[model samples]
Target chain A: MADEDATDEPQGPRTTTAEIVPLRLPPVADEEPEPLEDPRTGDVDEWGRSERVRALVRKAYDPMYRNWFRAEWDGLDKIPTEGGALLVANHAGAIPSDAPTIMHGVETELERPVYGLADHFFKSAPVVGTLWSRTGGVVAHPDNAYRLLHDQNQLVLVFPEGSKGPGKTYNERYRLRRFGRGGFVEIAMRAGVPIIPIAVVGAEESMPILFKVPSVARALGAPYFPVTANMALGPLGALIHFPAKFKLRVLDPVTFPDVEPDQPRYSRSRIMDESEAIRQQIQEALFDMLRQRRSVWFG
Target chain B: MGRRVLVTGLSTFWGGRVAQALEADPDVDVIIGLDTREPTVKLERTEYVRSDENYSILSRIVKATGVDTIAHTFLVVDSTTMSSRAMHEINVIGTMNLFAAASAAGSTVRKVVVKSAALVYGSSPKDPYWFRETDRRVAPARTRVERSLLEVESYVRDFARDNPHVVLSLLRFCNVVGPDITTPLTRALRLPLVPKVAGYDPRFQLVHEDDVVAALLFAIDREVPGIYNVAGDGQIPWSEVMTIAGKRGIPMPPFGIGLATDPLQRLGLVDFAPEVIDLLKYGRGIDNRAFKDAGFAYEHTSAGAVEAFVQAMRLRDTVGSDEVDYRYEEDVETFFRHSPAVVRDTPPS
Candidate 1:
């Protein structure tokens, strides 16, 4: 029996070749054209269930935590119902409470399980880390991202401006930062999905940072502490939070073509082009909205 | 095989000067000059191609000439001199035509050198310290001619990249002066009386025509391609130019016109052509570190150019000739009318 096992293992050593010959694979036939939907999408009503969770969460928290803050939404209905989607929003708050609001809005309003990025929050904390990893709260890795979208039919949200938006304090609020060359466009194209640009007004003002307490933030591994409203002086730090009326404005979803039938799924150029188009549309919309917005201060 | 070199707009005053410089270089085997009118400066080897508009001639001339290096020196301070369509057609489309021609011809061309102006820096009290190749143009330019230079510069750079071998060199010059320059500054410096003191005393830098000639020639000789500030070393107050003219036996400009008339003209109290207005208000200057680094040696100064022009005017008996034809006023009129928007607020990418 041992001799038979040895015979099955092959008795010769592998030989190395001096001349490298390029090998080509035989083409495979196209069988399944579309990707399989996640079981989550099947059992949970993606459009309705996600929003229900958001409403429940927001209702539970807002009165106690955000009495002064309001969520303003634009073009909320244009979110695509079936396929994978991309949501790009401006990042503002230091801790980036805006991401949570955005996630909540999409899940509650659009009714989809929204996966987004968290800087340090998900990276630490063992249980929350496991939850994030399972639920597809990507730590901003664009590659693992492809896998998440392909495997999960999930709505991926990105703050393309990254640190630029969130790091801006109250003194410099609402000023749009430079958009990085459109990578989100490429992702949508790869996933054969559409992009929904969500612009949130009043987020910048809510956490109005009077000045950056850089030493405190850096020591704590955070970007900066924005001294907002009553948070400047002693004792009243927790109670000084101001109620700034907030509005989250979502623009129309921008769609891109799927990877070409015979072409590779990941085409960088196609992705960049799609991203640029979406970015331009969002920028124009935001600029126009800002111009027409009646409420400057959330009052 | 010998290479073909195209020089467009070789009929204008500075263009004629450049054509003469190109004639001196033996490496330039075949020459093609594209101009609306036949070139007044005749070259034995140059093939003169006449088109009513620059756009019509660009592609065909490039194809026929098989030009590998296109040296552009087209100047039209006013777009209205040409039809509005013609202004864009000549300046923007004409450049695109060249780019298209280069792309279409698929020649072994290695470089394209375009002469742009430093005026695109706009009026600055010197926060830029010196306008580097990347310094943003701050002020909004008044005329279309000022604005088109930026557009043309960008388009040319993009075009050059389309053909990797076709690299671009943008030479931003600050008032090129040579023996041949009949510009109002040269002419004004040569005038007797009132010219003794240059009005406003703005720090000015001028590139000698010889230096400009050498720079253009170097663009062909060397393969180095990038934007550069081209000017002489001496930053002279306009007064120095008048001083040099004075020593050369030219009469100083009438002092009255600068103090009274210049201010009145600028203030709209007195009537003056746009050219005269431009001349009176020409403040701000460029930093020439890049030109110096590029190994350009200026053989003349703004003062020297003034001396040369004064000498020429004297030789032609045009200085103090009693009849100030004021054809420059017409030139200014034509420039405003024909030139496209000159300065763009956005910095070049």
Candidate 2:
């Protein structure tokens, strides 16, 4: 409306569409000005998840996931392409390589990162904790998970069976342990995210535990010192894997009622039932996969 | 109404600077500085009072000056000049005397801000990477000074609870580095051979002297209850700190440090406090979200803090000549140009 004051204009309202041009600027001193610090630095966030570190970790372990474990998977589409979700899987083996395998498979398949919530033990162990955090591992806590899911909208990977699954004896392999009074279910319910049950088959067999030494475990401040038949061979010999092919089955996502983190609509007993039902699904899937599999060394 | 502020420990740089800065503020009605020794720095409005560890004298000063705010920075960090026994008495007992005086002052002394170190958290294998205020502090009797500071904090806490009307804030600061603030870490990392723990390279989240003063001034202005961690952002490894200070690290074994620390302190080469070993082995830091929530922004980052100390060392190297000091300015610029979390501060042309 103020353009009428501009006498230089040819006309008030008559004009052809003006051609849009890309922004052009005069050449300046130091074009492409470098950042003050290295771009590779400060990649880690407050939660200690570093995309750069995660990328590097994935690069180092991709071969192991593919060739070493022969990890194969299905139903990644069950996870929402957007928004947060919980990937509740079974934990197994003395050294839990299952976290990495499941994380790698889901990350590569979904083309999105899934943060693994590690125990406080991993958060306290000097170099290990720092490295763990950099590699997209958050210290497992209700507040952390709540923030990751509700506030940050991140897909999180959790092993509800916890240390109980891995600390099991050789005979207890593939049997899903109690899911720690069902905290993961409550987390899922509170965060308002669907729970995708993940059943990993090859982990328990990959590093099979022949037996364990509880006294040694207690001395080392570990849950149990698993003395596998392969481990008895020696340090480097223990590293030699049996090449048990990992077949991952991701069941359909189970939705829960939306609630605030501190809201008490969901009781302890109901959450436990839901957790048990989810655990049963993964356990049954493991049995079915075992029925289909012809050999332990091969898929 | 204007703020009547009293600054304790005028002998210390932190106390003197805070006194002077508060004196400069037009909103401040009066500034009263108290210390055992005379202040090295000149002040404008602050009245310097030479006072001993007498509760009655401190209480009289508070009431006479009508001081509502007390900034306590006299927590003896460097005790090379004084005997260890004297330093303990001055730090612990003096603090108790001040608290007693302030308690006697009652609502007249509305606020008391105490300067505590991050060392209260202690360096341990079990410590969280970023310590929160709720995390358990170190048990008593870790080091002589640390134990004293711990006791002092408990006393302050008790005082705060007892006096509901009074506002008490405890600042847990990490290692502070700048031209003015001279700590043992800065002296060790000065030049040539930087003494360090053999196998450990702890990460230090250093705060700039400017940031420390700013935080103090901010607390003086606001009423933020409870304890808050104060430090500039980002952490630099101790090895990197030595490297940035232009020194080659001399890794000392634990036993060697234990043996030589006494002689080193005696020679005044460095203030080798007892807690230095644990600090060198395992670092201490805290998550400073509380400060952020209180609406304060830091001017310098951790990298800048270390860089400022290094620049000061360079300045000290060429103390007599302004031309030589100017030559060292570019080195600081170049050093900060590549440092993470450093802000580029260009002078107004």
Candidate 3:
């Protein structure tokens, strides 16, 4: 019976299949053959980013981007036409509209793909995670960032403040959160990419968090559950953002000449200093943008 | 002067396939296959040696046969196939003994090629888009298969470190799909409605079984002494993979998937193990560039592997179960190999 089972196993089918379809032999060492055509049926790339999905999303969100926020960009040309750059920005609002605004703006203006690096929390959610990935959101892992900036030579947008920026109450809106252990700076240094800081205004007011329900957040295994002013509009408020004039100011690209790329480790103090300087620059830029802004609803 | 090779788990798919490939090479003078059961595949010149799962007599065989290359393909990456304890014995203890024998005093083993799975990099939401060889698992292994594989790899790592002279290469292959191999993913794809985690379309990296065997051969031939991830180029989402296979996905509840699959397992419908469930949720991708850099070319991309598997499935459906012609008869093989009456054309080296 065991012998029968053994005979019934792979050998028979494998040989028969070999007769039908010729076995592909490995190419000789020097002469590499053309790679087998990838039979991918979807547009999703290795990073889970889909141009088709992004285009569809851009189409749906364009009305909100143009009319609702009326997002305006200053010194957009300061971003390089080519090569990799880490676009560091201040994150805010209940859901953080700044990321999409910046990504959509830069993608539309410069015609380059901008990958928004967010917390892995987005990836844990079922439908949300899939949507986030398809629409060009990658987890903010140093390895993922390095590959994006160095190997792929693609523009990456990251919020150094992280969930803290979005988790803050309405009162603590513009105040910058502590930059995450300066890991982003280290990644930029290692990837041999310059850090381009951008200050975003009106995101804090877009969906201002009145308060947070910690118990509910803990129960739901969420980062934070925020009760925003939009909640006053009832259930739909969670998805809706107030029409705040979104103004983005791009600062000069900061490069690290002293530190070498692909180092196992960089100077801790150096990373911290660079991170703090970028934060300060963005903070100052935010205040300047806010000062120039005549009104919240209209710029 | 030719290579004397020892292949573990001869009865298993990988072991039999590898031994068969080794037999075709004129340089491989002696092929001694070790397994508890008779080899499933018929081979011309390979000698089969029945051994316990832990390989108690491996040292004696290694010393007596003077096999220079050991292809360790006995590690169980699929948890659903056997009990946890049995799997532990085969994967962990089997590997421990194999390495012990290879590293024994004055051992003739010069090269060791292990067929490991990409399960070492656990599927998780925290994982990078592509796991490089250097990247450690984002989370601690929860399943028995993963834990056992991890333990086996640690042994391999230690063995490599201790025996610097031995050209030890650990090839971590991703989910493999092809005509001959049967894996959880392939089994699922074969189903009428491929089971998926609801609302999660994870990207999976699949390699062809041929690529896997070729990678093992590549490692053995070149004597590459580093861990390499052997996966097909590119990753395809689960939905896309299903579409390519011409099957619609039947989604299991995202939470409490065990509740749904337990009954299926009871009914012998599908064996959805915990690790496979996690994989269904968040599929894994590993960087195949390292092996490619070492001059090993893959015949199938991830999607190509799926296409090949689907094509083979279609063929099987048309062919009405392949007829098993070559049955392993011990006496016949023995007579052919050792009979003095038989004329010797190409004498054993």
DockQ of 1: 0.01
What TM-score quantifies how close candidate 1 is to the native fold?
A: 0.44
Off by over 4 Å in 2: A1-53, A79-86, A111-114, A119-134, A141-156, A181-196, A252-256, A262-278, B53-56, B76-88, B105-107, B125-128, B135-147, B191-204, B234-285, B314-349
- Can you write out model 3's per-residue Cα lDDT over A89-137, one digit (the tens) per residue? 9999998999999999998889899999998888888999999999999
Candidate 3 is scored at a TM of: 0.95
Candidate 2 residues A17-93, lDDT tens each? 11110111111223443322311124455555677778888899999998888887878678877788889999987
* Consecutive 10-residue window with the lowest summed lDDT within model 3 chain A: A11-20
The segments of candidate 1 whose C-alpha lies over 4 angstroms from its true place after superposition are A1-299, B77-88, B126-129, B191-199, B247-282, B318-349
Show the lowest summed lDDT stretch of 10 residues, model 1 chain B: B194-203
**What is the C-alpha lDDT profile of model 2 across B1-349, one tens digit per residue?**
4567888887687997787677556556678878877777755446667788433388788767667788998887654546768877777888888888888833378788998888778775445556777777533456777776778888888999998777788898888898766787777776468877775556567888877887887677667768999987766666667767777888777445767777877887666777777677556657776786766566567777788777887887888334321111334543565667676554222
lDDT of 1 at A203: 64
Question: Given candidate 2, what's the lDDT at residue A239?
Answer: 65
Cα deviation of B9 in candidate 3 (Å)? 0.6
> In candidate 1 chain A, what residue range of length 10 has the lowest lDDT sum?
A17-26
Choose the strongest candidate by DockQ. Answer: 3
Winner by TM-score between candidate 3 and candidate 2: 3
Where is model 3 chain B poorest over a 10-residue stretch in terms of lDDT? B320-329
| Cα misplacement distance, residue A46 of candidate 2 (Å) | 4.8
Root-mean-square deviation per candidate: 25.4, 13.2, 6.2
